[model samples]
Target chain A: MSRHRTTRQRGSSANMLMTASASAGDDHSDSAQDPLPSWNEGATKQAIIDFVADVTREDSPHFEPRDRRIAVFDNDGTLWVEQPMYAQMDFALEELRKVLPLHPEWRDRQPFKAAIEADFETLLKEGARNLQILVGALYAGTTPDQFDRLAAEWLAAAVHPRFERRYTELVYQPMREVMAYFRANGFKTFIVTGGGAEFVRAFAEQTYDAPPEEVIGSGIITRFESRDGRADLYRFADVDFVDEGPGKPVGIESHIGRRPIAAFGNSDGDLEMLEYTTGASGRRLGLIVRHTDAAREYAYDKGSPVGHLERALEGASSNGWIIADMRRDWRVIFPFDGA
Target chain B: MSRHRTTRQRGSSANMLMTASASAGDDHSDSAQDPLPSWNEGATKQAIIDFVADVTREDSPHFEPRDRRIAVFDNDGTLWVEQPMYAQMDFALEELRKVLPLHPEWRDRQPFKAAIEADFETLLKEGARNLQILVGALYAGTTPDQFDRLAAEWLAAAVHPRFERRYTELVYQPMREVMAYFRANGFKTFIVTGGGAEFVRAFAEQTYDAPPEEVIGSGIITRFESRDGRADLYRFADVDFVDEGPGKPVGIESHIGRRPIAAFGNSDGDLEMLEYTTGASGRRLGLIVRHTDAAREYAYDKGSPVGHLERALEGASSNGWIIADMRRDWRVIFPFDGA
Candidate 1:
């Protein structure tokens, strides 16, 4: 149902971040033939390619059937930029700005007033509860279809603060290539985000090439109503499920009904998902997209309230998770960036 | 995870139910190639074929893309047998019999007492609550993985009383062919059931060719715990969501995240799913499997407590839903039945 077309043209930009290392063993000189051209040849990149090869090789003991090759990726920091502020937060605040005129009562309300005034301090203090309120207000009265349209429209227009590119264009090219690579190899790629499922579903198909059904995330309860022989679903304010931290594994189990063979995530929120994925009795891969390029992208880790990366960062070595340092591993950040 | 092998043979059976009529418009003469050979020549079969062709044919006004060609089937009655007793209920009772000795309190408990005594009269009066109790007792301390194994073990051994065959073999051959037909046409088939999700997921892939992720149903909350560096999920007695009647649409919306183009159901419990599927603006199809074959299978409609089929049966004509009368539409009942 989410059929939004992306506004940006890929393969036209000439903004390469880093060049491929000549010393690397893999043949990635032929950009047209490279499944992951955006990735610079490195240990991280080789590890990913090797894992895929091992799992897919029919003769290998690590070989997994096509049905069992399920790979889950966290959306926010893993697939796209979540800094400057979470993209969903920016969307919510923008929505609050638009609706503030109608809801005069919100002018005096704590979270609403703080959000309207661009009071980051207060909003951060309130944390997820503030986001929930804003989400409820943003989605009020609109059906999922209508909300999807609004999200798509906003995404088409909204630009990243630093990059000044459309939010959709800011999606990580390497991650996108990884998704496509997995998909090509008969692996089902799913976006297991901590963001709103409906919000991410809006442009997931267009941006990530993952279908709406494959994007599992936090969701609000939707009530089904039939009026005048027309079936409509209404979104409620109550949180149905929160897919973060420990909830990630729960959400994965509920939605996927099986442990993923591989998981790509960024923060501690994804630690459990990584654990669940790699803990299964099979050859599995778990990778963390560590934000370590401040010149190209904001680099914040354990100290950042948005995507805290302490626990998972600490456990990466012990768990054998491939930590992809953006500056070292990725040749290009966004799809708009050139090789 | 659910790698259960069915204990049955494909080509050895010689039992034939009824021969196909010579009046079918489509060529089904090549028995080896007919997509739905077990289906008799009828309006219901024709309608189903026509809808699928219309939706899949390129340049057709009704054509839907491969991704949008999602078809949902109700599990209990629509896909397989649930007449003499709901299969999940039978499994639960069998489990109750196994665990009844451990809990002496159940010996005096109303629902448990009635279940232990094989008091169908009292159990029927108790209704869903009894099943919930039985389910809770059955899955007490077992993790989802453990429960899946238990279910697979039970299904392999369980037999349908009337058919005197494995419950898996008693699956309607016509419906199986229809599922295969839909799948062949690039439609993603899903089992949307009121039965326990875990129970259905155990054999869905093997029996229906529907993966565990494709089977959405009633569920209990699963608690996530990390013990001795191993992640485990324990199923609780708490009801998370019920995928029955009104809840079917909700489950579909939550899991599938889009309206299915086609829906197949057998009872009034699927009324909402049918309405939700057809009410959407699209070329949609809704079909109800009416149990009118007393000679081949059990025949009970409105008065039947197991799968009451009154409201849906009455509304089928007005809703433009196809009613596949089991006795008339189906040439063969079970998979063991011949042409």
Candidate 2:
């Protein structure tokens, strides 16, 4: 039998007692018994176990449907490599180079000029407004379907310069296991991110096993109408809504209609989501995946220009949010060869 | 057995199934086996049936847990009476008269002046914006808990002008039956409305049996923090977000991560929510409650001064949305005096 099926069989038999007394240690031999063997034993692991235990115990006050145990995760740093620069920015820059011939004016525009010239510092100084402009320019005048196809194509071929691996392949294996583990336990996993909704949704299913509809993110305004005697929806660059920080909770509240019992993030961007999730009455779990291993992966946190983890760390302990120490809590980082 | 249980047992085991297959020409007696005999056999009945069918059919593609089947309803025209002005508006006007002594400037304000003189025509012309201003002014400066208590007190004694019954008792019997039916089938019912979230939450459980967190609505922003060595979250009059029109979908998308397969609305404000819900790829349903019987309830659509249904009616047939024809479909409207 396959390893996962064997684990499922053992889980059904051994873990069917519906009690809260399951050992909190990582001593269980996971060879064919636990599918999540790579997770480390600590606050992060304990939080997951305790929350799931309380929710699964029929006698516990917090017991809820295994189906209602939805967990939403921020994608950028939490799921895959977002350091150096956002992986999507790299893709946009490459696409810009390819499309430069068509848009000759971009060679002279300030930020666009800097982008074409490969000046990363100038781009950073421009901040959020510039980023919005870049996103609008990259995604404008394209149908959502076409944009998805382009995004999928870019993700398949794009490689991280530092790791020299395809961007899709750089996804953290431990996090992937977490998604699978949650699904195994009857939790509906969703990707709620600040990235373009259409952009991430295009490849989320193929990469994370999360379907397109389950993905929620920032979106451009779109209009539905008939074109050429067939129904068609046209996407425009006009700002629709931004899904970040407090907006994350707002987005989740608007789209899902049910508050998630669990949330995961890696930086300050996800602080609001974790706050909202943990603030919910009853058993809740909030986790932050801290990139603290520079050797295996990148390690800068509070001082890092990208995915800064300052305010989140300040409130982590007090708020009871688990900060996953990459070097200690994760047995593996990226699924890179020889890692 | 209880009356409902006895009636259910007396009918054929396939009573509900037979009712489902019966043509629209069948009278209310066809549903004699239905546990909720108080419900009328129009759009409200169809909505309940569609939702229950989708959630209960394990073999059907739309099958889902009863717990996930959340049904939200607007209060005024949907659950109660909006004719001769909204009941809440009357309460607000009364409260304005009582609070006018504190704020002397209100005696000269246009809308408040009209309100003081019972000039409802002027108030209606001022529209929703004026109502929002009044709510902000009245609801401000008080703690959220205090406001909730005040609302509860008002709800306890407030009476509908036309019905001569407690405002809470103005709820439609057919809709109430729908609520019970949904609950029996395992659906988590909610009240997504433009009413104050905390205000409606205070009395929703007592009136409609819907729990506090399940009620989403418009309200002032509040801060969750400690104050002067005591823990207190205070509500402020700052308009946070309006739960109407496009905001309904935005609110649903943010709070609930999963898209509802079904939705119900009575006005143009609910149009976006119905659109969003029905836009989902799978088997989805949307229903518009058309108030068409002036004797049982106020019949107004298209150009009605209150809760206009022009846009909704125009698109209902094309969108495949069920239009609840109150005159032809319902056997009763309100629960009080066996209406």
Candidate 3:
């Protein structure tokens, strides 16, 4: 936290796309025929449509080259549901319960015990590092196959407490459409998240249509070995890189070698990514998805534990970032709602 | 090196694709009309053809889903000529002369003096670390724009010492065809190189048709900052990640998330990547390029300073890795040499 605490709440995603007179430009010519049907006809929705139209139009001066039309999205809160705690965190807790029999001593361990009892207050008091260590210990040293099987199986079976739906279906319809829209317009969409890289990648391809290669996120160290006439790549418990805040841009540059033209995020964790993305030379969009729907989805800002949107929310206005008010701007919050 | 050091003096690229009897199959009828026309027909050539065919055919048990079709290639000796020193080394030398005026004291330094004097023996003696420090110093702290300008300018003007042609034109024709061949068969081609990523990406798109996003290689730390209402990403003089040997697999997992279906390289540095890629379940191809063509390219093995092909070559036989004999296997070398 101390390594990057300078700009607490001063930057976010931008919106201003160039218009092109190219013959094939904007087939859905007006906001009336907007592709983002899940979004209400508002400034936020308009900004998105305009940005996409401008970038894809060949004649636009601000148009990014097709290969450079990189759109990066934050996974947890921005793309899908991150409420009732992050899905990965939930997965971790569930794993803790399942693995408790194997680790009887974990009942006395601080973070492990806190996790077992679902003591949110104790877990928070114990802090991020302890939680990370516990999670890492739980998931580490497994071959890709073994980890994948466990995660995939858990994901298939696990249902959201409130929605009573499989977590995979928890994805936001608007975001899904946005991804499809970007792909149709030749933009390479990537998920740059603070969550586990492998965790996001496991089901992102099937859900978001963004493949494994396009995902950039936090990861642990991995080792390669040979066994039984086969090579094995397995995960270890050490943090390889943390793809959050300022680290977001670093990860983006390292993996993609190009700054994204568009970035979507919802917390202070995403502030630097928003700044890095929108701060590009020209016509960049930085979007902040403000969770404002308490009825349909949990809405908490400033300091609610999961996805604290304090600094970034305050910063969004200053940067002209589109604060997508979920309550007001989105027509449908979830896929099951059938807008 | 201890992390990954085994096998020597054997293993390189393969060829010979399968017949299109599977449901979702390659349209290319046979190896006689092979897409890799630049490669001389042999088991090595046939093996590559067969692997692509097998993995792409829907009915084949080994068939990879289209999204899982990732093919990684090493840059230096594998895709282009690394002999007479690496092309990047040539770039570094040229940069050294241009920057020598600023660092007159550098003449007293071992690696700097070696670089300034164009003394290959002394430079090699000073070893990789000192040389890396010199090169990192030469390129570091410059904004991505300035560095890009410098690299692109140098690439445009500089000519290969032996070939009297731009270094970009020195890419191997057979390798280029293989990239195209895999791409045609729905495999996404990526460069997983130990060379400087930016240097390769600056010209790779034009020369190899592998865009900046598709190019993965070693990189240094880069910082994103803002001044005069503009953002700049400047490279620092620190090694962020070296995509060499063991580090190659780490980079691939971090960036691409999924194991590549096929891996190609020419040096010991690529051993880990080769193992990581081909070691994955089901059908996988690991190809090594042996620089045995002295007439068209420089011939070196076991102890070449540029790309030492030692342990990897020795271990290839047991691993069933294909050894691409440049002299015997490649009918044509450089693309400029003609069809």
Candidate 4:
């Protein structure tokens, strides 16, 4: 539920029925031989292929043992649509709506009042602070298990307004292929997100092929209590750590205990993570997913309310970061767009 | 350096020169055939063997998938020796000695002076509070990599006084065998310690065959800062979270994000971890190593200054936790005691 805000409007809706043939016509393809079939043949795709080959090849000077092959990816805009708002933000807003009846005091409060009435104008005026207040109140007293259940239930029934499909179904096909490709090469792919860890954990395994432990993100403080001879953890409203911007490096060190060889992100929130990752000695990769295809997916960068990508985009060339232009590099966006 | 204070004195020193020939005469010999050859034929060994078989057997009602077969072990006494003091406490004390000259004001400080002078009586009188002050100061501003180097260097040069062996060599051979057995059966073994995570991670991979990510423990707050275009994390004096007693379950949840099917420990610090692990539905195992072999290892369990084993020991029977008596259950205490 945490994001910056701007006045940019949502772009064109994705053509869900559009076949892979549409993108294929304008993009080069070696779908028959490529491990990343969803990716068109381009410098961006070649960078990914060549990096994997270098680290995994036994005789190569850049060869890294399997255990050291760690790769991290930012969630929101990089893996899925974050144009209208962050998916977690939408989930939090809906949660606020559901709980508004119980707390009438929320009807008069600034953030709560705007949020309860679905006033995007007032909410966007002060997004981060308002969203933090709402999310903190919404998730405060729930246990991790309770939060997981809520997230799972919400994700199951909730549909993205633009796509008219389940949020889980809106994950990028090419990113999923990239994750699978990394895993197949013995690289441990971890989803390092700015979203709540528990929220992402609910569907990370099924949606992203990442296990619960592999997903690191922002977290609420959790207290361990013994209740009726049973051990339980209660998530508190206080923020434990935020796994965004500079926190990405701290979270990676705390959770993974190793520097990732490759990092992928879509915004300035991931700038520090990419810097830490690709800055390490030896062959490394830093990739930025640029949402340039407005026809297939929403597009916004510097001025976008959510996932504003100005500084990282500008520094990509200097940092040796690959910027994957969605319109040019990807053969398909969502899985429904491909065979 | 965090531990309970007790008035009990150190137990008998281990006979490092005592060969396998001595114990082999008294213990059963099926070394070539047994997976856990260091474990004697007993109810404790059988309990571990049976639990692994039941979960791995496809026909068994208790069968669990490979990914769910998680086994966690407490580090201090369960995996290695914590006799005269906890090994981490010893490391902390040694670090204090090296840094004493740099902090002249510490010469007059109660805890610092007492620790520097090797005044065990005063240090042990108010152990937890005094040790906390010393440890907090010692590890305050160092980066994780710096801390790792300090711990690694100390561990390499440090030797256990009684056994005249390096602290790493003092690890329990029986416990090592059990870890190997679990891994061989597709179980991921993790060390859920009450000690500093960075301290354990320095040697975990080499000494215990546990990767850094698998060693969950207490941690200091870390901050990420960018210096010279490089991201670095600096450890703060403030304690982030302690992975002991009630915090064990909390740490396990934060790090592994799954319930361990099997839990192993040797003290009250692991009481809640054992409770949580064994309390879960389905096939579960909880085993505690009772340091009853004074001649082979150290044995002052119930009233020991470190690794106190009272509440957990008393509740073991009612909780269906297996108590592995070190004297009777282990054929060899350390790897040096056996082939």
Runs in model 3 lying further than 4 Å from the true structure: A1-34, A97-132, A226-231, B1-33, B100-132, B226-231
TM-score for chain A in each prediction: 0.86, 0.83, 0.85, 0.85
Looking at candidate 4 chain A, the ten consecutive residues that score lowest on lDDT are A1-10
Among the numbered candidates, top TM-score falls to 1
- Per-prediction TM-score to the true structure, in the order listed: 0.88, 0.67, 0.86, 0.87
Docking class of 1: acceptable
Model 4 ranges with Cα > 4 A deviation: A1-32, A108-114, A117-133, B1-33, B108-114, B117-136
Winner on DockQ (2 vs 3)? 3
lDDT, candidate 2, A86-195, per-residue tens: 87678778778788899998889967887787676677453333444566687777756577678878887877889888877777767776776665565667798877
Any idea what lDDT model 2 has?
0.66
DockQ of each: 0.24, 0.06, 0.24, 0.23
lDDT by residue (tens digit), candidate 2, B1-339: 000000001112112211232212112322445644555655556665765676667787877653246566776677777777776677788888888899999889866787788776676563444565677778876666577778878888887777778877777766666655654454555677866666677666566655454577775655534457433345555666677766666555434433566777888877777776676576666778889888877888766656767786787887878877778766666664352
**What local lDDT does model 1 show for residue B82?**
91
Give a tens-digit lDDT track for model 3, residues A176-276.
77775675566678899888778877777666656677788877777776667666677777767777777789888878877789999988889889988
Q: What would the per-residue lDDT of candidate 1 be over residues B95-205, giving only the tens digit for each residue? A: 788877888898898777887897766775633445665786668667888888888888999888878787777788788777767755767778999888888888876
Q: Better model by TM-score, 1 or 3? A: 1
Docking class of 3: acceptable
List lDDT for all candidates, in order.
Answer: 0.77, 0.66, 0.74, 0.77
